[model samples]
Target: MFVIDCPTHGSRVLLSERRIRALRNTDTGVLLALECYCGHVEKISTGRRAPARHVPE
Candidate 1:
């Protein structure tokens, strides 16, 4: 799961399952572009590298 902070809407949403479109590092932190099921797209910062996730087959 990841926290998405929407700049345009000035809101924060919790996304448990979603797709990450892109990832980029900037002076502030790590920027992640994500798409939600509700058709909302936004960019968010995690401050640091998100912990590695594992999935069971």
Candidate 2:
């Protein structure tokens, strides 16, 4: 499962594996194609080379 900021849900949602549409390998990381409960599909990356997060200190 993975969490993404879903526009329909108006918050981050933990998507289940059943909603996953596809997966791909990239130089940066793993590409994940996931579907939100509202039927919105989004692709996100994960792994060591993925984009860095700018969290508030």
Candidate 3:
């Protein structure tokens, strides 16, 4: 439900449901990877971007 623009790769990385649950449980605020528009990936934080558009399946 979150989107982040990768500085290294100009792609949209979308957060998955599993990642969302994991994030909610954790407190360390780690960076997790999500699928990109081009099928690539990048890591973003809960602090970096807010959950916006729904991630495509």
What lDDT does each candidate get? 0.66, 0.84, 0.52
Question: What value does the lDDT take at residue 13 in candidate 2?
Answer: 88
lDDT tens per residue, model 1, 1-57: 766665555666666654678888877678788886566786666665554434222
Which runs in model 2 stand beyond 4 Å of their true positions?
54-57
Model 3: ten consecutive residues of lowest lDDT: 19-28
Model 3 agreement with the true structure over 1-57: per-residue lDDT tens digits: 766675456554555554433333245455566655555555545543445445443
In model 2, the number of clashes is 0
TM-score of each model, in listed order: 0.49, 0.76, 0.35
Deviation (Å) of 2 in candidate 1? 1.9
Error of 2 at 29 (Å): 1.0
Identify the runs in model 1 with alpha carbons over 4 angstroms from their true place: 3-18, 48-57
Model 2 lDDT at residue 49: 92
Question: 1-57 in candidate 2: lDDT tens per residue?
Answer: 777788888888887899999899989998889999899998878879999765322
Indicate the TM-score of model 1. Answer: 0.49
Which of 1 and 3 is ahead in TM-score?
Answer: 1
Task: Return the number of clashes found in candidate 3.
Answer: 0
